[model samples]
Target: MTRALVVAAHGSHYNPGTALPAWRCVDHIRQTGLFDEVTAAFWKEQPSFSTVLDGLRSNQVIVVPLFSSEGYFSQSVLPAELQPRVGQAIRITSVVGSSAFFTAVVADRIQKALVKANFPPAETAVALVGHGTVRHLDSRQTTESQAGLLRGKFAEVHTAYLDDEPYVADLVRTVTCPNLVVVPFFVAEGLHTQDDIPDALGLSDPLYESQVIQNHRVLYTPPVGLEDNLYTVVLALANEYSDSEAAADPGLSSELYWTSHQLAQFGQVSLHADALCHVDDDVNAPDLEILDTPEAIRAKLRFTDSGEFRPLPTRRDLPHGWKIPAPGDVSRWAALQMIYPGVWKVERTCSPHEVGARQQGKYRPVRDISRKKVDSLVQSVCLHCVRHPSWHDQNLESVPGCIEPCSVWLEEAIKP
Candidate 1:
């Protein structure tokens, strides 16, 4: 039996930061041994809301929404896809906005800002900036309600937005305090939180990148939902349900990922290569063959067992500043030398070659350890793996916004 957690949100198709905070929380929670599998999905991004549930293996899945409001997307759109028409153990948790704990998290951030930035509540006013979309009245309701929670501590509480009146820029006119603390009421730090919010306020520096904006003092803080304490709110929501009956084994097929980065650290190839890039089993893979001229190298066996990220169209000549450092194949060493003779070198084994001529071989059940010596001998350097067949073979057409850059050397795929 197995259990899984899905952290669902609105992610970016272009910007990675848009969905990172929620993904970061999902990853951190996964590490605590609460679930066997953890994954993330977004409405505007890859592994989209339309297909997020398909990858889940656990019959008992706890899905927690990372959104800031209980809007149409959360109440209707998200539930419609997840709620079973007949029966299933899948449970959906509350959005972060409804959690009173989230309000406290925001308050906690305000208190910290007052301490670090030296702006006490007696002198500083807090402005909670939100999107406040005019298309839907419910969008601004949470931002308006959350202000009541922080009113007692601050000299004055101001609520502002980008689309509605009393916009983010108008904060300069509405609040009279000499010191103002601005906290973005967003789920993640992306274009709006990091770039647009600053530009709207006529700020030269990036969002939350400084304690003070311009000459006059103003404390800028990151998105509120990303506060560490909010993880408690998520766990609490899932724990509300009673324990379920035992589940069946998750016999799901997993795709393999590769990267030299992880292979260098552990001196083992199989255990860590999944860190580079991966995709769930759905899309059909194209026939892939790794060949040098008419001959395929022995290293090709590593890829034969599993696929890699998007494959390159035609091999580009090695970039000037980059080299393979150690090409794992002894057969390819000659060809690599033909291209750039001094680019790579093969390390010799530390065997008693001079004393004895006898050689013997035997089958090893756990071959993962046998490759360690070769992996250690090879000098692995960073390569732009996005184009290689190894990258393309995983069947992912594009990288997700929330996923960190792939480091293939780590078995756990994501690297900060």
Candidate 2:
């Protein structure tokens, strides 16, 4: 039976930015390739919750709300829109906040801060930042709940807010811990994590030690929903009702999943060209290369891993127009694209133009690559970048150098 996972999120009508975290979670889950389809729906955006099932062919669908609380939206609004018809099964999982293992996830995060700064528990203070809507008492309950769990382990535990009391700007005045660590209880690092909250707290940069705000130096971590272990948390949330054959690989680690190409940049690994077919081979393979025009270069610009171009074997068609440089040319391709964007596009498909659009003065039409093929490539690049050491070891500013060159940072965004 065809199965799907529809992640439901309460998106914004006024600000499209709020939906990013849910979109990110959707992207994260989709990369695992655990189901026939993984998609997203927003309550206030296009494909709103009311029409969430308008185009689903899956026999079973598991809708998991990305909310961190089981308030009115998860308990009432989302459920009201998720009715399934005969031969179509729709199962709704509990909100992510209800995950039984979340406390453990919190514990792990706290430990990382301790290890990073090696601060004495006696002096370091932990503050959990939340939306904390004063209108709804239950809204801040999750923040309170996590703070309670962390209190036993950290010397100082504080709960600050954006909408309610104990404003993050006054964190130092309210929470008297010497070295403060603020963890945003957010689904994603949208405007709040990236700006509003940081601004309130006087943070000048993202993911770094902030200049003393109100006389206190603060260290802020990335938003909570992007946690690596949260994959397990999400799977656990979906499995409460998912009967599909997909099983979570708890032991599978992306820690070393770096492609051989990435490793060769540092002389840590090698790709022997003699053992592989060269790009000049004329082996007949599927022509899945998409073109925007006759001028479009037909190379495997999409970095997918489901399989290779059967028409050509290995690096045989790589460096499409030039000789594959040395053995680790694929990584070099990524580096070249990064350091030399202008030069790298020479071999990539032409910038996609709308079909029937007038280019220069002549009308031109073009077709896109097969969705499945692009999906395969996008997933491969996503997995590669998301698991790269730079993603974890370095901050966001340093992160793009690895992604932009690889063309995984959406040089070719899927027009969802």
Candidate 3:
């Protein structure tokens, strides 16, 4: 029987780096050749929860939330969005953050940070900083649990929160330790880890590796979620669902076999005999860079023409004037995936009406908005996006269209 693994994560619309750890984990798992398919889905980004499972062909599926705590997202949002399938046997595993393996990973991070700082673990006080919410206790509970497990190994292990009582700033100011190490209990290094945490810790300089704060030699480590061995924790969480007895099918090949018709257009990108080109007519004529492989295409799309990082590929800001050679059907489909991840599968599985209904039903922010508000939001947000809501009506198969309202639009609609 075919098996699939879906790594669910809370991706960011604003910061692209927020989703890298989960994607990296997916790449590692895909390399193992254990599952027939491996894909990453996000709550706030593309290949969203609404469409992640739409195109899977697996008989058995396991979804592991790449969350650090059994908080609002992992406990409530994920289960609600990942609806039960009709024929497939789907199992949602406990979050990676709650796993015993993750606890060890955090401990390992703290130990390594201490050793690198040349501080003895016995004399160092560890501050486990978490993004807690006042609306729920799960975040605080998970943070305290990890701290509890490390109390004996360190001089003192204190749990602090960005949103809850005993705030991160308070802990940094009052913790009694000659040497302190702050470890962010986050899945990725986003604005929280890069700016908020550092600011709360009283570290003004962004480049400072270590600083003297309140007479304590403070050493801040990268977020625990960015740890290189996180794939092990993901595998450990899904171990029960993995079939050791079943012979593994060599997973989906990178070379996608597509027919000539399917290669004609990819949203705003078009394929030609000599090269693959952007369909947008308004883009300024720039020097066309030669991109031969899918990897090269992906690298080119990472930034805009002006060299600014393009976090969202669906945005209309796709840097133009790049040419990809039209080698074979494999290269064509592979290039489409690189340009718009999961769009081809989603287009095949869902109709325009189904996608529209999903956006209205699954996303409360989109559903709650008035028709006028939606029109205004769309004019402001969707107009600048490469994908269009009306593409289906226009019968523009080449123009990538939104099946459901994206997180960016939802965020705009929800704003007061």
Instruction: Tell me the number of clashing residue pairs for each predicted model.
Output: 14, 6, 1
Residue 354 lDDT in candidate 2: 27
Pairs that clash in candidate 3: 267-400
Off by over 4 Å in 2: 11-24, 27-34, 44-47, 243-416
Order the candidates by lDDT, highest first — what do you get? Answer: 3, 2, 1
Worst lDDT run of 10 residues, candidate 1, spans 354-363
Q: Per-residue lDDT of 1-416 in model 3, one digit per residue for the tens?
A: 77888999988766767877887888788778777777788987767876677656677888999988888887777776676456677788988888889987897788788778898877789998999998778877878888888888888888888899889888866778788999999889789898998988888664337778889999999889888899989987776766653545655444332243444556578776555778863223456677875446766886788987665677877777777766666556556656766553225333333434444334554444566776777689878876766522443354555665666766666678
Winner by TM-score between candidate 3 and candidate 2: 3
For model 2, residues 220-267, the per-residue Cα lDDT tens digits are 877676566765676667767788666433333222222234332321
Best by TM-score: 3
125-157 in candidate 1: lDDT tens per residue?
899988877767887888888898888888999
Better of 1 and 2 by TM-score: 1
